[model samples]
Target: MSRRTLVAGIGNVFLGDDGFGVETVRRLSAPGAAAARLPDGVETADIGVRGVHLAYQLLDGYDTLVLVDATARGGAPGTLYLIEAGADGPVAPQTPVLDGHQMSPDAVLALLDTLCAGTGAAPPRRIWVVGCEPGSLDEGIGLSPPVAAAVDEAVRMVLDLVHHQDEETPQDEPGVAAN
Candidate 1:
């Protein structure tokens, strides 16, 4: 069987650096670009600012989930991060109340977890984040220079991840836990 992967770009294009994910995915999906280079079973989507929609999409079942977004990890702008959401499961940290319009990657994962529990759907077996350090997420229409520069690199990283997973033999059925 083949591994199914979903590369979801999540962010708000209206915000400055917050649009990294959207931009990266846009580049990947461009004509004769990264999307054409991808292998079978790999899918991409720009889930811009719609966390609820992304959460529901997760229920569709994928072996691996790659979330591309601008993450504030206190690094210089354009710094890329590959974060493996631990095997333990989604971490739910107490945060200030959020409105319907905003949802961070962590929040989306938590929501997916809750929704999965209710629907009895299995969450993706592995979750990886291709995050970029943002220079600013202030109200604006475009990315900062550094963030814009990192889009191509982020796209490469995501492709590498998908290819790497494709080469590995699964130790268990896609999303099913092995004892």
Candidate 2:
């Protein structure tokens, strides 16, 4: 069976390397880009700084969700990490905050959990996060040199996660384990 997958890029373009996700998806969706060759049932969204929108969109239902964003874990700036969620089940937050501007993937998931429960919508069956260690998130309009160089690799990693689950690399590598 084919999987309906949403690959969402979330972050703030003005916050230096935080734009990593935004830029990566831009390349992925470009004409003749690698994602163009993928089969149907895959969609890409540049949900820049709009975590609430992402959470609401999830209510539409999907088999899989892949979120790409700048995730900091004290590694080298270009290091990549893949985190899996939804396999275990949706989050059960004690007190969820539904911030309109909560852009981090975790916060989005928390908000999603609440939404799905209230609306009786099922969350994605599987979720993955393709993250890049950022050189800086300070106010800026562009990525640092290292983070900029990592965008291509990040795109490849996202594709790999979407197509080949067994070959995922971050199971060995470590990062923020949640969200």
Candidate 3:
């Protein structure tokens, strides 16, 4: 069977910079936008702050999951990062704390792990994160200057990732890479 991929954008639009994921997916899924250029069997959604919902969605059985979000890795704002989840091993389960208002990527993954453990559902075969370094996640609307500037680039990155022709070579450690 061909690979099934889900590109989920996670974050809150009300919060500054945190909306990177949501905005990127918005552009991708926009009418006559980049999403139409994607290959078949790929789906995209803006799963904002809904960790539980996202976890449940994962149970549908996709071969790959590409999560787009703002990740603070102590880098300059607007820096893009490509992270391969479970690169080492299964993620350790964290205490289940279901917050309806907010859910970080880590939390969502942990929740998925827990949910899968009970249902015998195998997690996605591969997971990648197209993350951006946020300038600020404080209460506000829209993205910061640098982060805003990176949106188009992030969209391009996600497209490349979904196409399985990522421009950057995989590295041993997930570090800040060029946009």
Candidate 4:
């Protein structure tokens, strides 16, 4: 497959704002979604709470991988952060805990590192985390008000990355993609 970019969304929908990634990707994949017009080779998936599954999917080669998730960084809820991580990964400092049931981006990256070692599948050249500050990770079905509102912006951010990455370094405010 000529998958150039993979925008994977992973999170626990049962936990309120923690579902941001899942929701954002849902919007991005909608039939008429703004990001739907992306050129061929960009792929998106809603990998809800499946850390191990994401690790295995890396077997397919992609030059860039953009992960969308809810990050609790002690910032205000709904805040957006675009962090570009090295090949070793963004959460390399912390020890990754491998759990099929639960895995943070850190854990996922660590698992991928190990997989690449044994399988010889090269990891993506660039990795990015488009994260949103979560309000409540508490057990719940719906997102908090603030988090729900930020979904649109998060979608735009992902669109920006896949659209402009090859053209130039992504800007803080990415330009609108031409039709």
User: In model 2, which regions exceed 4 Å deviation?
Assistant: 86-96, 165-179
Instruction: Show pairs that collide, candidate 2.
Output: none
Model 4: per-residue Cα lDDT over 32-113, one tens digit each:
8566666678888999988888888977878888898888777788887787766342456253466578677778877888
lDDT of 3 by residue, 1-179 (tens): 87788999999989899999999999988878696888898899889888778889999988889999998888899988988887777666344448755566777788888888999997887888889999998999989999999988888878878776333444322335633
Q: Compared with the true structure, what per-residue lDDT tens digits does model 2 show for residues 81-106? A: 77786556655543335656654677
Question: Cα RMSD (Å) per model?
Answer: 6.3, 3.5, 3.3, 4.1
Q: Give per-residue CA lDDT, model 1, range 24-127, as digits (tens).
A: 98888787869898879988899998887888898988889988888888778988887777556547734322434767777788888888999999888888
- By lDDT, the best candidate is 3
List the candidates' TM-scores in order.
0.86, 0.85, 0.87, 0.88
Off by over 4 Å in 1: 87-89, 93-99, 166-179
TM-score for predicted model 4 compared with the true structure: 0.88
Point out the worst 10-residue segment of candidate 4 by lDDT. Answer: 170-179
Indicate the worst ten consecutive residues by lDDT in candidate 3: 165-174
